[model samples]
Target: EPEVTQTPSHQVTQMGQEVILRCVPISNHLYFYWYRQILGQKVEFLVSFYNNEISEKSEIFDDQFSVERPDGSNFTLKIRSTKLEDSAMYFCASSEGQGSHQPQHFGDGTRLSIL
Candidate 1:
């Protein structure tokens, strides 16, 4: 079965620095999304991309955050300025279609540590 894959399983960066989390979803998936889980906190949705544009985004996806599919297969999340509170496990997911009915497959995630 196909699955989502993320690179650089772990990343360490200083506060105020920039970081990019990368992922590659199942080849046939059409919707891609980014989510993060802070230690002891619930998983929060960041943004979803479809048809080469942003389909939906949560408030957490402020100006400081952005997502892109630069090579048609890879989806990336760029955080312009990292903060201590930004430390979390960022997960990349993809689904064949939209809505709650469609199952979203997740990657192992990139654990980001902001110092």
Candidate 2:
């Protein structure tokens, strides 16, 4: 089955370092999203992208964070300056349609570690 794919299943970064997490969403899905789950917390939305633009982003997705689709096939999340609190499992998800009605396909996730 077609599914989202994320690179470097495990990432380790020093505090104040930058990291780029990559993902290739399901073949034909139109809506793409990024979410992260801290060690003991629920998954939280980071940002959503559609039609080459960011549709929405949460406060946690501040200046230090960014999202992009450079080649029309891969979606990326960049953290310019990572902190201890940024350590988490970052997930990539895609859906054919929008909102709650659409079922999103998620990748296994990239585990980010900050030290």
Candidate 3:
């Protein structure tokens, strides 16, 4: 079966630096999303993109963050200025729009560490 894939399972960066986390969402899926999990916190939704624009976004998606579908299969998230609080597991997810209740499948995640 196809699955979402993220690169650099672990990433380390200093606060205030820039980082781009990459993902390859499952092919044939139409809805894509990004979520984060702080060490002991709930999985929080960041943003959801479809039809080449944002469909939904949470307050956590501030000026420091951005996302893009640079190609047919690749989706990317960029943090223009990272902060210590930004440290977390970044997950990429996708789902088919056959139904509103369709469940999303997630990648293993990219663990981002800020120094």
Clashes of each: 0, 0, 0
- Can you write out model 2's per-residue Cα lDDT over 1-115, one digit (the tens) per residue? 8879999899999999999999999988999999999999999999999999999999999999999999979999999999999999999999996667899889999999999
lDDT of each: 0.95, 0.95, 0.96
Question: Distance from true position, residue 15, model 1, in Å?
Answer: 0.7
Instruction: Quote the RMSD, in angstroms, for model 3.
Output: 0.8
TM-score, every prediction? 0.96, 0.96, 0.97
- The digit string of per-residue lDDT tens for model 3 on 46-76 reads 9999999999999999999999999998999
In the range 1-115, model 1's lDDT, one tens digit per residue, is: 8889998899999999999999999999999999999999999999999999999999999999999999979999999999999999999999996676898899999999999
Worst lDDT run of 10 residues, candidate 1, spans: 96-105
